[model samples]
Target chain A: MFSVMPDSAVRIRDLRKTFGSVEAVAGVDLDIGDGEFFSMLGPSGSGKTTVLRMIAGFERPTSGTIELGGRDVTSLAPFDRDVNTVFQDYALFPHLDVLRNVEYGLKVRGVPRAERRERARAALRSVRLDGLDGRRPAELSGGQRQRVALARALVNEPKVLLLDEPLGALDLKLREEMQVELKSIQRRAGITFVFVTHDQEEALTLSDRVAVLDRGRIEQVGTPAEVYERPATAFVAGFVGTSNRIGAVRVRPEKIHVGIEPDAGSGGESGGPAEDGPGRDGRAEGGAGTGDRHAFGTVAEVVYAGPATRFVIDLESGDRVVALQQNLRTSSMDVTRHRGARVRIGWHAEHEFSVPETGAGTAPAS
Target chain B: MTAVAGRPAPGLRRRAAALLHRRPLLRLSLLLSAPLAWLVVAYLGALGAIFLTAFWTTDTFTGEIVREFTAVNFQTLWDEPVYRTIALRSLGVAVAVTAIDMAIGLPMAFYMAKVARPRHRPMLVSAILAPLWAAYLVKAYAWRVMLAEGGPVDQALEPFGLSGPGYGLTATVLVLSYLWLPYMILPVYAGLERLPGALLDASGDLGARPLRTFRTVVLPLVYPSLVAGSIFTFSLSLGDYITVKIVGGRSQLIGNVVYDNVGAANNLPFAAAVATVPVVVMLGYLAAARRTGALREL
Candidate 1:
């Protein structure tokens, strides 16, 4: 893994933004490393886009300092800033041909006609949209239009590229494909990308670091694994992944152990921890729980996905937990039989993380 | 075919309904065609009578068309540079008014379309066209007083130690431009109102400054509207008689010239001949507008 760059590409410190009665972006502080793939992960109305717009110089922060490549550019206009944006609508000029749209920035900067044309062609080629220079935006498909928007931004060679749900318009398959293409392009271009998306999997899959946003505030910031396994708050854990939280405690991914039933009382008391189990503490002790044995629950539902069977278990505390397993083998009895059947679900103590609760009766401010 | 919400109407009933609806349309078309045909016929007949009269030598005593054929009137018009000079002056005034209308209308239209709020935009746009809604004669009379020596404009200037020029071609041009500015503003505003805002934002993100973005992205998008508005302004100013008649005491354009020739001078043939210049110019502009795709946009 790459360590944080000493000279960050973007440094946002205590950035605050408010729109009339609503505070869209509360004080936010983030450092985006050079050439790093950074994402702001949040639900709708979480101020992720507002923050991105501020970085792109579209929205002036109410107060704070913003630095790009170690130079402060807080008061600059968007054109004066080094950042570029790919809007959700891909606002290509409907009147201009694709080539002109791509060459627009350089032309504005007074680049020579021949040189701008050559650069525009090269940018179009980079997006694999060569020979489409003659088409208008209306004549292109959704994906092609997206590529044109990319080419238009990329042609400027901006130091910071901000994507505001760029793939939000595409269908599922196309969005997935574009995700890969976008990641690869970012790598090749080696520009620091400040991607904004509400999709958790998208953020986790593409980002070197993710900042989980909630109610116009940054809840937690860490790598995908760090955020998923050790979310500082319950909101971060639940929002970033499908988490089964039991009060303030959550069942970790690998801790979700699955097995076929032995005989009745064969594993001892169902509520008690199993013998020889590496418990949550990573050590075995004489107690109701054992090493790798955390809790037991009855199977509430079993969904037979093509590759994996997802089981929802109801624990004694009435908390729900999900257990996923690959379909490596078939049992004599149907997996459906496990549904409504009393069963034991156990995991190591180390697989459970205790985090502060959210909403009403949540943990008091520290 | 019959109209349906989001779907195409099919079958014989739909076709029958569609055909039946066209009956009134056809009737309306015929009704409109009659007036246009009558005007054309009357104008042509008048031109034919005038051509014959121009050829006829005016009675030395009465100065009336004698209904004879002669080249003497054409000779007279060519012999004096005053007629040619007057004709060119009318063309110049019309051209100046049209150019001014276009220059003022564009930014106003752009502001209405892109900057004004949706609720206020209609009110603001209607305000721009308010002059057109006012009584035309009253507006012309008002301008006559305003541009006079002791009007509010002169009064305001008097405080600054300046005075009005009283009456001239310049005053007439100013009044005509004011009256017809709405014709240009409304259409250009309509064109800009139809343009989407997303296109502007996209241009900005693509690194275009505000001015560059307006020039390349916005101006081209509203080109048809601009042309349509300019055509209306040009034709209206060229063919206008009211503003010039009221404001121009002696500095008259072709409109006044045509009027004075037809009624006072009793020179119908020469008046008809003078009117033909504006018609030919308008037709040329209209052909150019159509070729450039402005008509479809309008």
Candidate 2:
């Protein structure tokens, strides 16, 4: 079911890497489009970084092939590959100044001194580190060093740029800032960027397409929205974003609505305030006319986050589900009052996705 | 509270500890006093006496130090062509030994630090250090036997229609390099061990081949440790007299001259004057090495 793109920048066929007895990158197939900002998103030890390293020729596949720009580079040394990696540690040469670190690739390739200097300076400018050429990597701040690493890799103008959690070392504010800068840089460079990160939010925010890896295998590969909305596997559903599994179906927290169940004699238009007691019945399911699946549950916990409030409900169907509500109209007091109150949780049928149960047992907790 | 029945009233040790805690500078001085005194008196005092004696002359008739400060000893050292030759030869041997040690030590250290499996590293380091546990004279004498006529070195070379350079500057340098090789390997190994593997990967990812990466990345970063290792090899080779005596047949080095004047001729002042040469050269070498910021690594 995998379509092979004729102009794909990177293509892998059953790529596998085994470290002794442990399989790191199990058999996998992928095709990354030219100039696409692709991300291999996974938790630590999920083999995303190994895949990226194999793509960069830092690693060799155990029994498969990796094609870069349609050339089989499985046996080539890292230097022979037309890709550069911005290491997780930045890996800027501690002995060289920023400009020289950027100019190293060109220098080794026998680029003339004057031309390489000019190109390196331009690269430094692209990363917005123009005046800090004389400063060594140790002299720069964390974010600045990260930029120098980016500039060093970018200066080569390789066919692909591999970034292995380049922003993982930065603080939250700086990482967010770098995310914007990196996206813009990738756009301007128009080089196929294969970014690897364990941060799901970063993968979703930065990548045009993301491959979610689990246990050395790709669980799902799709656009961020597709992975988030219609996760192919239960693992992807739980990993990419918060998923509330209700039996065989999964629904996002934000899509589930929690409301006070109306009394038996009350009209359907409005539900009166939920009584200060346990849910009316242990099990109830209705609202089929509106094509909405409904369940009766007691609000187990009410969490008031600043922008949104989360309600953890233990449904009567022997399953627990969390529902998120924006605080645009509900204040802290309004959401906090839902604790122990009888409520009806409902979601549109379209929002419910039936994920395969193969990897469900090993999916990370929501 | 009746002084807490059985508790001793501020024992001398407790009181001293409290006093020490209250006065940091006093405590620091007390902590450093013994070693500081030994360094100043025994080490610096001896060095100062040597420098002082280098300026003094001997009473030629009575065979005693005149205690009269004069440049005559230094003048004699300068005027004598043999002394100059020995000093230059000694300097040359130290430089050659250091060079040879580096050439061998670097790759050995790299293999031990980076290429070897992690579990095997400690064993490799101890292997490099195993020779150091033997007595210096024992090792030198062993080399002396090895370099003797029809010795292993000579017999090995005989099949190739060549003979070993028996007992001379070549033998001195060969033996000295072997003796000081551990010194070079240790620092270089520590430096290479401290070098992060990602830096090498990053260099290769930047399109530089392995050799280029070593030249551009590994060598420059490891240079400080190389200098640190050279400090040990250079100074040890420079001040060594026993090794040269064991292998050097007719050649004389600065250390040999210093020894000969003191032992055979009973010329303490002239011996001290000759001793100052290596000390001066070491000081110069240290200044240059410090400029490279290698002393910090040591």
Instruction: Give lDDT tens digits, candidate 2, residues A99-134.
Output: 899999999899999999999999989999879989
Pairs of colliding residues, candidate 2: none
Candidate 1 lDDT over A1-366, as tens digits, reads: 433567889998888899878989888888898888999989999899999988988788998889999999999877788888888888888888999989988888889999999999999998889898899899999999999889889989999899999999999999999999999999999998999999999999999889888878888888888888888887877787777776556785435654433122123346542322212221223222233555566668887777667778787778888877555454323566657655455566676787766452143111
**Worst-scoring 10-residue span by lDDT in model 1 chain B:** B49-58
DockQ of each: 0.48, 0.85
Instruction: Please give the lDDT score at residue B146 for candidate 2.
Output: 94
Candidate 1 Cα outliers beyond 4 Å, as residue runs: A1-4, A252-316, A320-348, A360-366, B1-84, B194-198, B202-207, B261-273
TM-score of chain B of 1: 0.79
What tens digits encode model 2's per-residue C-alpha lDDT throughout B251-272?
8888888888898888899999
lDDT of each: 0.79, 0.87
Which CAPRI tier for candidate 1?
acceptable
